[model samples]
Target chain A: MQKVVRMDDMNGVASGFPKTAGAQAVVEITDLSLVYQTADHPVTALANVNLTINKGDFVSFIGPSGCGKTTLMRVVADLEHPTAGTALVNGGSPEQARRDRAYGYVFQAPTLYPWRSVARNVMLPLEIMGLPKADQRERARAALELVGLTGFERKYPWQLSGGMQQRVSIARALSFDPDLLLMDEPFGALDEITRDRLNDELLSLWKKTHKTVIFVTHSISEAVYLSTKIVIMSARPGRIIDIIDSPLPRDRSAETRDSQAFLDVAHRVRQGLLAGHGKDD
Target chain B: MARMIRPPAILTRALPLLFVLAVLAVAWLGGAVWLNAPQIIDRWQRDGKTDYSTGELVTAAWSQERPLLPAPQQIYADLAKSFSGRLDSPRNLLFHTWVTGSAMASGFGLGVLLGGILALGIVHVRTLEKSLMPWVIASQTVPILAIAPMIVVVLGNIGLTGLLPKAVIAMYLCFFPITIGLVKGLRSPDPLQLDLMRTYSASPIQLFWKLRWPAAMPFLFTSLKVAISIALVGAIVGELPTGAQAGLGARLLAGSYYGQTIQIWSALVVSAVLGMGLVGLIGLVERITLRYQAVPKAAGGRG
Candidate 1:
């Protein structure tokens, strides 16, 4: 993997978003397991998987629906706890990290508050964390502008198109200046044209911010195009099959997906996914 | 590209309201003529059965009044007199009876507070929702008339005679719609929105104040409009059992007892207008709040 070691060199990732501290592994999962207790049975969602995410790296987890990519993301964000083993953020437990406001998570849906204007929705995390009002406003405005939603601060979520709303969610995730961003199929709901545009925008934002990101997606091409490291997982009680390092250059563009190097990485990811498909059966 | 980016237009919406007003004017004019013809001929026959002259006919048409369908002109004149302080003069028919106004105001206020609290409780607690929701529906199913006397007599015996009794009646009828609307509104947040909040480690208080409260604004206003109308009905019914007060409801009862049709009709009209005005006030607030949520269709911009 082409490691981005210097925070000062990570410019143009986001408009006014601070670079990560870059000295530590921000997220670490050690043999994590997750189970959901239903009425009739307890379903194990994830099993004994270990991974480490360093600061400022763009990493992605790619697998099928039942592969626990989203489950792992949820565990890392402390939205859900692992049934066994443990996960840590910046040397503390996920719960402590959540209390310290260590990360921001964006879902497949935009999920912007319908009543709030785009700017206010972006400011939600800051307000909840009880930041100074002036700082919240400044960060919100900068985040909106970064997402190319500069003129849409006063507009409600429903008034914006789906792609715009997703961008607003991204802007919201960046507004709080969290060290890590956990995204679960953030662009899955968008159409092809919008998805392509957003992928480019997300890459640009990642490059500028240098915030360590763990993105979850099922698309092989998308995984290869965006991430420095791609973790492939097996379905049904998901365990990590392989974590491959991409050879693509750090400075990416729309044409990066079409390049021979990108194609080779995507091919490997697809084969890994296919091989890991029947582990449950 | 031009088709996709259409220019702003206001003409389309205005056309429908214009058509509706025209239709209403036509219907009113036709009804006015039909109502006047019978009374005019009867007046001519009763005054010695002579063939009416043009002047006499015109006078009769203008002057004739029917008990069932009172002339719009007469209602208008009465409305004008009431507003102009002629009717409200102490010597005149419509004095500013503090008794009636006080009772109505108190009753409506009590109803709103009761309904609001019940809704909040129901929204926050599931057990209360399961227990109370069905009973609320069942309460509305029974005729308000059947319940009105029981309320007045029971409360009157308990010495809760004036404000509390009347307010209880109003609340009894008004609470259901408000509770249902508010519950739906409070639960209106999208699943993803809830997850986003959860990711932030937001407490229930934070989630509600930041997300649920604002989302419920539109629904709350809608229920308020419905509740206001019911509150007026409850207040009027509360006045019916005791005609001792100087309210429009007491006026209505007095008119019915003495066979004074015009007085009853005037009181009815007043009640309608008051109810409409109350709902309108809430609607005005709704408009202001929703404008912040609404995007002007003409100015299509991206977020």
Candidate 2:
């Protein structure tokens, strides 16, 4: 099952591939399939997946619980491997890209080390990169400040609320300033109000940094609100069913969420998700 | 809200003190009845003209007419006698026997350090954990009494006398609790926390020191409390096998041999006091260390 979508399918889909339109792709995945060999049996997770993500696109993977969206995100982060696939990041293997610090991964939960304060947690990647002490400190503070966590440097993880902790995790992700930010349900656990606030903050951050983002979420509203392109995946043996181009404007604000265009795109994404459900059956 | 709730100064401030006083009163009353204070006092009056004086009651306990137990007054007097060196002038009881204390101190220190290092290794290396965890559990199964003589004899033959015999014994007893508590502590990091550290790209050493080690503090203190008491037991046990001179263990031995029940009882009290002090010290350090980690705006921010 080598399902592939040509470039025509992604036309005007907000990939912004013009930076190196003629050059080699940043991430090129083909014929990706995954199966985990459990004691009971091999569980087929993903099958016949093919996609190309350019350097600075805001892409959202929207699917149900068993759709393998997170698995795909993990695969891209080099945290998990597909059973059969040709997956590459930045013209290199996923592991090589991970080693070269080309991607920053944010998990569903804000897995901040409770013992380390916010700033220290952010400085961790910098330390691994062997950056100087002063540079680590400056970059950490800058990242924290960018996430609106400026005065919380010395605060431990437990000291913050769930939203604050997630913000800290985002700050830590941004600390290294990687080209690709792989987020797996980063705001899925938060309340609706906090999620909306974080969405705005994320869009502003994304606009400023222009880093490639691959976000996995089960929330339709979140995908519609945040993504330039939304990839809807079918459940069980997950594969992309539809890649919807959101017609909402890029200069988003609170009022933009209430706009008719935003609701129309959200409705379209929901329809795509419903179509995916039919495909699964 | 003002009428329903009392002032913080009046309520929160005085509540704990009142609670503590109530608990102490209950304990004192219970102890008085359980000890049969009136009967003990009558016996003391009756035996007031006997060999042991009223002062001896403080350090050495008495059993009225019986010899099974010493009275509280008798034990108190013995404490004075032991410290005053009046029993045998030149060779004072507590002073000449300070060796036992040094032995216990050295043994406890060595045990804590060794146990701490071993815990780190076991927590990190799965193979070491599989091999060593069983032996740790097995070590506790061997009765200290059954092994004490063998250890003493072996050390004596190797010309390793003095604190070595006792320190080894203390370490044997102390390490198990430390290892068990520390393993749990090191493993206490939530999955979310571990993922965070991984995301930060923290090295193994950094992870241990910054995350696992600090997280293990409360557990460490709990085990240290148990281990310190066991260390004292080990020190005393070390004294028993050799029939050594100086130390509370030796004091217990000598007292039992001469049927000086008061002497043995007083030495036991001293050991208990020492053990309590060590546990208290660990608790104090725990409080200080945990204070810095405490979330200030948390419900109970009194740390």
- Model 1, B130-154: lDDT tens digits are 8888887899999988888889899
lDDT of candidate 1 over A75-107, digit per residue (tens): 888888898877878878888988877888888
Q: Rate the local accuracy (lDDT) of all candidates.
A: 0.78, 0.80
Model 2 per-residue lDDT tens digits across residues A1-281? 13323432443253333333553356777778999999998888899777777666789999888999988887887777899977878877887887778888888888776657889989878887789999999999999999999999987888789999999989989999998998989998999999999999999999999888999998888898888778889877888887776678788888887999989988888887888787656
Error of 2 at A103 (Å): 1.7
Write down the C-alpha DockQ for each prediction. 0.48, 0.47
Off by over 4 Å in 2: A1-24, A278-281, B1-74, B84-97, B196-203, B295-303
Winning candidate number (DockQ): 1
Model 2 / residue A213 / CA error / Å: 1.2
| Model 1 misplaced stretches (Cα beyond 4 Å) | A1-24, A39-42, A278-281, B1-66, B81-102, B158-164, B296-303
Model 1 Cα shift for residue B179 (angstroms):
1.8
